[model samples]
Target: MTDVSVERRGHIAVVTVHRPPANYFDFALIHDLADAFEGLDAGDCRAAVLAAEGKHFCAGADFGGGGAPGERVDSSRLLYREAVRLFRVGVPVVAAVHGAAVGGGLGLACAADFRVTVAGARFHANFAALGFHQGFGLSATLPRLVGAQRAAELLYTARKLTGEQAVALGLADRLADGADPLPAAMAFADEIAASAPLTVRSMKQTLRAGLADEVAAATERELSEQARLWATEDCAIGIAANLAREVPVFVGR
Candidate 1:
């Protein structure tokens, strides 16, 4: 069974990440999403809305879940490789971020061409707080969406931004007035689907030219730094503190 489901709404595809509670990601989830997007490339799917079926959109990777039940290094590499495929999809995607999109989840949202979020929705780049380098190509995507200075602030401070703040910062494209954001996101995708499919696809390709390559390069660099940081005592402390819901004390290690 796949963790993702793709349903066609006219020319728009609604891709739901169907994990409960936090909807954390791993290698399998990434592969599932890649496959879903690849499948959407066929048929009449001209645009897509990426949404999650949980309380929080996604809470990042489940660090306490033991990580995909495989060799950690190999799994991480495979996860990133599949994640890069998300950027290569031909159809433009509008992400519906209803709850929290944090860490890698925020990167997933950033991968979309546009984001539709509810008022109280949260966006965070918590890599530094985790004592790890940002992954999922966030190094490229975050700055691309919100500019260098804002991206640097979000990463360095690891502060959470509400939907309105995210829109103000250019991190999110639209803020829905209601509680549910998926309908608004799907509406946006439907508007895109109303256009000429080929023209839309071509324009998207032009607008996002070289983005996948940039993300690929950024992910490689991120992984390299993360590998080194994963061995540090501070990283362990950060993880422990997060799990305990407390503040971490980093000794610059």
Candidate 2:
């Protein structure tokens, strides 16, 4: 079964990440998402909703699996390449983040033009907590969404933000008061789809001018830092502690 699937909801294409449970992504899943987004360009899709089928939007990547740090870095670079394609897509996207969007998952949601989340949803930039440098172009995207100082605070503290907090900080666009955020996001997309498609596309491109280039450059720097940090003793400790559900005691090795 494909991890990513696209369905039509009027003029809005719903691109869903179908990986079960936490929907932790890897290089393959990222490529699938890119493909789904690209495929929509040929259809009647005037807008899109990016959502997931799982308990969380995405819990992040699984680094605890057996792999050399070098291998992990290599895989992450490939994933980021596909992730950049998500930013280049033509249509405006609204993300429905119903559960936790942690680490790179948070970055994925930020890639969308808008996000609709629930009050109980969570957003976190956990790279620092993992002793890992941020990826998924968050170094650029986060600062763009929430400003430099707020992004710095989030990255440095690695704190979790509630959905309401995300909206208050302008990290998320809307908070769904109802149970499911997908319908809210689709409704928002429908509103966008009601507009002239060409105008919407042009406006979206204009608003996001040079953003793809910025994200590409940021990913390069992020990957370079992550390549170095992935091999650190502290990173390993953090990963172990996360899997064990314990507070990580970083010795700053």
Candidate 3:
């Protein structure tokens, strides 16, 4: 069964990620997302609202899941490869973030053109706390949204920002008036769909020029760094701490 679904509402494609509770992503899910976005590029989808059906929008990768060390590294590589394809798509996307978007999940939200979120939602770059480098092209996308210093602060601290705070920092585009972000996101997508298609595409192309290539390069470095860190004593400790809901004391081995 596919965890991703695409629904058409006129020119707006509502692409939803379906993984309940924490909504942790894997290679298959990211690959499915890229496929959905690329498929939209070929059709009449002028705009898309990226939504999720679960408690959390995405809680990043499931570190607690079973996988051999080498298999885990390979999966990360494949996931990042598919993630880069999301940046190459031309369709404008507005993410409806109703809950937590953590680690690479935050990177996924940043990949969109705009994010419509609620104040209750949390945006976290938790890779550092996980004892790994940030992946999923966040090194490129996060800096582009909130500047180098702010991105560094977020990545370094692994801080969680509420949606209002994210909007204040220019990380999120809009804070929804209602509790849920889907309606607001759809409205935002409608605004994009209302524009002249060719001109909109031209503007997007100009504004996001070279972004895909930049993300691709950044992900390459991020993957390499993460691979090295995954074998560290700190990584194991951090993951165990996270699963246990405790703060980790990294020895920096």
In candidate 3, stretches whose alpha carbon ends up further than 4 angstroms from where it belongs are none
Q: What is candidate 3's lDDT per residue for 101-220, written digit by digit as tens?
A: 998889889889999999999999998888988988999999889999999999999999999999999999999986789999999999999998778878899999999999989988
* Candidate 1 lDDT, 159-252, residue by residue in tens: 9999999999999999998889988898898889889999999999999999999999998998888888877888888887888889999978
- Give TM-scores for every candidate, taking all chains together and pairing residue i with residue i: 0.96, 0.98, 0.98
Q: Of models 1 and 3, which has the larger lDDT?
A: 3
1 or 2, greater by lDDT:
2
Instruction: Sort the candidates on TM-score, descending order.
Output: 2, 3, 1
